[model samples]
Target chain A: MEEVLRIEDLHKSFADLAVLKGIDLAVNRGETIVILGASGSGKSTLLRCVNFMEIPSSGRIVMNGRAVGRAVDGKQTYSEKELTRLRARVGMVFQHFNLFPHMTARENVMEGPRTVLKLDPAECARRADTYLDKVGLAWKADAHPSELSGGQQQRIAIARALAMEPEVMLFDEATSALDPELVGEVLGTMKELADEGMTMLIVTHELGFAYTVADRVLFLSEGRILEQGTPAEVLTYPTQEGTKNFLRGHGSFRLPEPQLD
Target chain B: MEHVWDFSALLNNKQLLLIGLRNTLILAAVCLGLGLFFGMLVGAARYSKKPLLYWPSTVFVEVFRNTPVLVQIMWFFFAFPIISPFDIDAFSAATLGLTLNTTAFSSEIYRAGIRSIERGQWEAGKALGMSYGEQLRRVILPQAVQRMLPAFMNRAVELLKMTSLASVIAYPELMYQAKIISTIEFNPIEMYTSVALMFFAIVFPLALLVQRFELKHKAR
Candidate 1:
């Protein structure tokens, strides 16, 4: 498998607090990596650094064989223009969906293409329609975010990201804000994307979705990866005591039986 | 003995009052346009993190906001011309005062409006790979402007009324014209009353528009 994204010794600190300490990761093309950690364990921070939302204190990030930030005296310096371009190629979805409330679903989907790619209106509209249809919200194209349910809005947000045609998509607790019944639709849409071999980096608390969908599950603890392996390995039999304790804390989750090869 | 109320004085001064009305609109329009435009810049500056921009903006906002606007107008009229290179007339003085005042107050409105939006919106924009300008113009401002509309209308109405303050410096706005007419015709009651009514005619419609906007926003 070709490595599409590589992070070397990523570190992020906010003032006196160290959030992520020396996290090294590599993501292959078409791989879906599910990050499981308790809140404040640096899970979201890791995902954020990948897209340069939160700049790493000291590290190297290589995406699609290109360096994200310039190396100056052993520290990474990012230009706004470079980061902006990087973000276009790396899409992200948020917990609240964060759809532009002023815009309709189709317009929200059209925004990235129009602004970033400078595509013509007709082409932007076409991409919007195609992506919205893929996410199964084509009929709700004209509806504002306030007019749609949480699930429907999230699906539109997905379409908005997909319209950018990103090399890898980052989902930052995409369905965590949804009502229990609404979670399935967003996850179902994600599952469909995974089946289509879209590269994704998801930071989530949904153990069941991770168990069934992830090619590799990583358990993070206090700004470091405690354990990582196939879903059956990490979810079923974690080696580290921290990973075991973390999984035990989530007692409500029941993992599905692993498929026999 | 009952006081005789005469109505002919106002009709006699109709042309003078119309000129006053015209001046009032010119002052309000000029100030409002310049205030809103500069207000956005000042607000963005105040919102900025760099001390070079932030401290100066904070000082500008605080000085204008804390002091009475009448003092600002009088200062521009009586005090500024001593050191000012340009000619200071009634119109220029009033325009400078009101425009700066409106800029200060409206800057706060812009700041608050922008702040009221969630951080998630900004993050979402950045995640989409949009530049700061793109994010602000395309994503942040569109939502913020909607929330800011009623406040801005309120500013416009207040600004219209505030134009009367120019009368202290003898600018030929509606209130100043009314003062002159009242003195000549000895009809202070009628003159002031007519002025009030005229202001209400202009301001009441704006007030209604604000309410409609609030209702629509709430419905959304």
Candidate 2:
């Protein structure tokens, strides 16, 4: 598989607090990478840096072999226009859903295509409906975010990001805010996308979903990847004491019993 | 003997009063329209990070807001034509003064509305690959403008009331017309009362509309 994203020697700092320290990562096409970490472990920051939402203090980020995102060289640092172009290929789903409250679900989906793609009105609407249906939101085409439940709103957000036709999707704890019952619906949508062979980088706490869906899982601790490997190796039998302790604290690492009744 | 209140004299001067009312409304409309347009630009500039744009916008808002509206009217009426290349009549002077004043107030309202929007909204727009202008026009402003309607309406009503200050320059607004009639007919109570009623007729309905909108938004 071809490399879709590469991060080298990435470091991020806010004042004296160093969030990311000399991290490196490479993502291949059609691969799902799940990052598991405790709070303040820089998992979210690393995802943010991948898309230049938070500029890395020092790094080289190459997307599809093109050097992009906060380059150290004055000539290489992308302009606002260039940054917008780069960002289009990398869609990000925020934790809060962040749907435009004033617009209907369909309009929210169409916003990027209409504005960035400069698509005609009919094309925009058609694509919006198509993507909304993909996320199981075709019935909610006319409903506003304020009128939708949290899960529905998040699903609509996913549809909106997909409308941009990004080659890679970054999910920042996408299901953390969802109610437990609603979490399944969102995770199911993600699983469907994964089955379709979408390249995704996800920061999440759902150990079961990570073990089931992620091609590879990375365990991060204190701004560094403490360990990374296949889910069975890392989750089922973690080599690092930190990873083992973290997983034990979260759960027994045993799958829940299925209800037959 | 009961003293009878007579309105015949004021009614006889109906044509003059109507002209005054028409002028006031036209002036208010022109000023409000131009003020809102200019105010959006000023508000955007205030929101910008560049000191070149932000400092100048801040100075403009402070200068106009801190001073008295009547003084601004007088300065534009008297000093503007003398110092500037263009000449202006009393009506233009009044209109310009009110527009500038309204722009300053409206800009602040716009600033507040824009600022009130969460930073997460902008982050979401950026993450979707939107340009700054696109994010502002599609995402930020739509949400901000809805929040601004009540405050904007309040400022508009205040602008309408401020038009009476134009009477100082003999612009023949309702108050000016009433002053002339009161001097000529010696009927201050009836003539001024009629002018007050005319203002009430125009403003009361607008206030009610704003109240209705506020209630509806609250329900949402």
Q: What are the DockQ scores of the candidates, in order?
A: 0.93, 0.79
Question: What does candidate 1's lDDT look like per residue over A1-261, in tens digits?
Answer: 999999899999999999998888899999999999989999999999999999898888999888787888888899989999999999899999999999999999999999989999999989998999999998999999999999999999999999999999999999999999999999999999998999999999888899999999999989988889999999998899988888888975665887889
Candidate 2 structure quality by residue, lDDT tens digits, A164-196: 989999999999999998999899999999989
The most accurate candidate by lDDT is 1
Q: Provide the DockQ value for model 2.
A: 0.79
Fraction of true interface contacts that also occur in model 2: 0.80
Weakest 10 consecutive residues of candidate 1 chain A by summed lDDT: A251-260
After superposition, candidate 1 runs with Cα above 4 Å error: A252-261
The residue ranges of model 2 lying beyond 4 angstroms of the native Cα positions read: A69-76, A252-259, B1-3, B79-82
Judged by whole-model lDDT over C-alpha atoms, candidate 2 comes out at: 0.91
Give the count of colliding residue pairs in each prediction.
0, 0
